[model samples]
Target: MSIEVGSKLQGKVTGITNFGAFVELQGGSTGLVHISEVADNYVKDINEHLTVGEEVTVKVINVGKDGKIGLSIKKAKDNPNPKSGRHKSNPKNNRNGGGDRTESFEAKMNRFLKDSEDRLASLKKQTESKRGGRGAKKG
Candidate 1:
């Protein structure tokens, strides 16, 4: 069949790489399901979700002009509203998955900026101190 964008099709996993899995779609067309598209959550390893010779349902998210088809296994699944962005919860607890996030996105961003600035300032101070008093003792 013709592989078009937004079409769901059954494909066989022909190869697995660190970045993504190559799926052979109907009509002998091969597509790549990126590692990030393998699951709803973070997928550091594509092999953990898919393997060679495995049949999976993939959605044709994109089709490049150069014959490259981009597929998404997670998108093929029936999810009315898929969550976007990194799914990290409870920043203080340092755990993943859905958890109580008392802080809003803007609050979290501001907190991160403050922390980052503090760290950068400390680093600058340390470096300046090291270089300020030392300009080659005798050279």
Candidate 2:
């Protein structure tokens, strides 16, 4: 079967590597399912999700001119509960979420300056404590 972009097909996992998994598609063609495309969440290891000789449904994301096919297992599965992967600014939790709210330019600048000063002071205190205060020597 000819592999086309945006087509979903079942394939056998032929090989597994640190970067991705090689899938044997229909018509004796092999494709790569990159680690990032393995799941919606972060995939630290490909082995955790795929195994050799296992059959999985993958979506044809790209077909290169050099006959290299890019597939995504996550895209193939229909997500019943879709959650926003990106950070959405919630107006209700402005203080807790640290989200941008309607504020004047001067007010924002003041807040930023205060935050920066606080962080710097905390870092200095940590360093001082680590070094056993100023002009302290290691024994």
The candidate that wins on lDDT is 2
- Give the per-residue lDDT digits (tens) of candidate 1, residues 1-139: 6777899999999999999999998899899999988988789888778889999999999999999999999899987344455554446775334553786899778877998999999998889788774563754
Error of 1 at 15 (Å): 0.2
Candidate number achieving the greatest TM-score relative to the actual structure: 2
TM-score of candidate 2 against the unseen true structure: 0.75
**Where is model 2 more than 4 Å wrong at Cα?**
87-100, 121-139
Cα lDDT computed for each candidate against the true fold:
0.85, 0.89
lDDT of 2 by residue, 1-139 (tens): 7889999999999999999999999899999999998887788988888999999999999999999999999899977236643354466757636655567889888988999999999999999998789888778
lDDT of 1 at 36: 86
Q: Which ten residues in a row have the lowest lDDT in candidate 1?
A: 80-89
- Candidate 1, lDDT over the whole model: 0.85
After superposing candidate 1 on the true structure, give the runs of residues whose Cα lies further than 4 Å from its correct spot.
80-139
TM-score of 1: 0.63
